[model samples]
Target: MDALHPHGMPKSAAETEARRLIADWAQQPDQQPVRHFPTAYRDTTPLPAYGTTPPVPQPDHRIVPAWAAGIAVASIGVGAGVTGIGCGAWLVLQGLASVTLTSVLLVTAPFAGLAMVTTAVAGAVGRIRAAVTTHVYEGPVTHHTEITNTSHQQGWFTRTRNDIS
Candidate 1:
């Protein structure tokens, strides 16, 4: 069935009905194209020129004055210095604000106590282990001794001797 005609009209009937509707629409006065007629009078006045010719192009060489350049450099340096000082001050303030005694103690007290307890326990355990443990030497003992004597004589003459006992 064609979706455009729910009554299940034949294709030929649908085409004929569409053609009749188009013809009826074309015959209506509002749908007809309007005719444009040319005017009998003509305008003879010339239009006024409001634009002027553009100026001729010229090559430009821009040069900055020495004093002006110096001023620009000075200003940039001053600005950078001010910014650096401001940032330093801000960092110092932030550091001071964040490092309160209460906060420092609160954050570190538990760890400090834990470390002390751990150190005490470790020390006690180490002492007890050391007291209960004993090590004995199991190798032969040997002794070595060396004696040396050096004398500088006249005219860059030198004598040296080593004795091992």
Candidate 2:
């Protein structure tokens, strides 16, 4: 027995009419409403995937802090000055201790004077460099950027042609 008409063709006019109404409703498109969705959500196509994941972006790591640079410059300047002064003094004292006054004056004075002059020049240069040196930053920097990249994939044997009149 057909499940849709268990009792055979409708025996009453009302049953015949009811069956016709259901058939008509089924034929109408309104009976099954078409779902509406935004374009972004409506796509059902699967994206092509490679075995490897996209590379993770690496942040730049070579920056040196300004405070460290300043400290380094200051230390170098101080060391150069101290070395210059100390060596000059030691040379003069050694000459005075070992030699007669006239000999010490003749043999060591010029050498000591040269040493002190060289040291003075180095210190002055260091002081000028420190005063002129510019620092990159006092703190870490945070940067933001927006990028839009578009690429077209072309097949082998494809050619672009231009026509001119």
Candidate 3:
């Protein structure tokens, strides 16, 4: 294989030279790029002297309420299981009563089952939501949020360079 071509295939030398020149030109920095202005309008003002140091959010690390999430998950699982088993039992009872006893009271099984299941699901969802909401700061580690002013001044043909700022 020659330098002009690879894999025993031939390409136009002029095209290859043009591609190389274009790549070199692309790598060069822009000559007349937009410049930053010293007195240009700014998007954000500097923090006030009193509030220059932002308040650091401190996490509650005295105790971890990890059990809340666990208990909530367990409760949700138990609720689902109970709902399933209760509904299945009610269905079975309804089927048995329909075949053997043929009583009008058998129709109430579905309603009872539905109510029980709805209650269980609601309780589970409530517990899960509580766990997620109230279970914050569940570790010994503290978290912090940092706010930085990154807004820069901009203008046409401004003398200020970004590197100096």
* Top TM-score prediction, candidate number: 1
Where does the lowest 10-residue lDDT sum fall in candidate 1? Answer: 47-56
Question: How would you encode candidate 3's per-residue C-alpha lDDT over 12-75 as one tens digit per residue?
Answer: 7756777998898788858565788788544465566774565556898786479987898999
Each candidate structure's TM-score, on Cα atoms with residue i matched to residue i, is 0.30, 0.25, 0.26
Error of 1 at 11 (Å): 62
Cα error of candidate 2 at position 22, Å: 77
The parts of candidate 1 lying over 4 Å away from their true place are: 1-50, 101-165
Q: Candidate 1: global Cα-lDDT? A: 0.84
Cα lDDT tens digits, model 2, 94-140, are 87688777875898889999999999999999999999998776878
- The alpha-carbon deviation from the true structure for residue 165 of candidate 1, after best TM-score superposition, in angstroms, is 99
TM-score-better candidate, 2 vs 3: 3
Clashes of each: 0, 0, 0
Residue 22 in candidate 3, Cα distance off native in Å: 6.6
Candidate 1 per-residue C-alpha lDDT over 1-165 given as tens digits, one digit per residue, 9 for 90 to 100: 544556688777899999999898878957656789887755566655776644545899989999999999999999999999999999989987879789889989999999999999999999999999888889998886766665656777766666666
Q: Ten-residue segment with the worst summed lDDT in candidate 3? A: 156-165
The 0-to-1 C-alpha lDDT of every candidate, in the order given, reads: 0.84, 0.77, 0.73
- In angstroms, the error of model 1 at 85 is 0.5
Sorted on lDDT, highest at the top, how do the candidates line up? Answer: 1, 2, 3
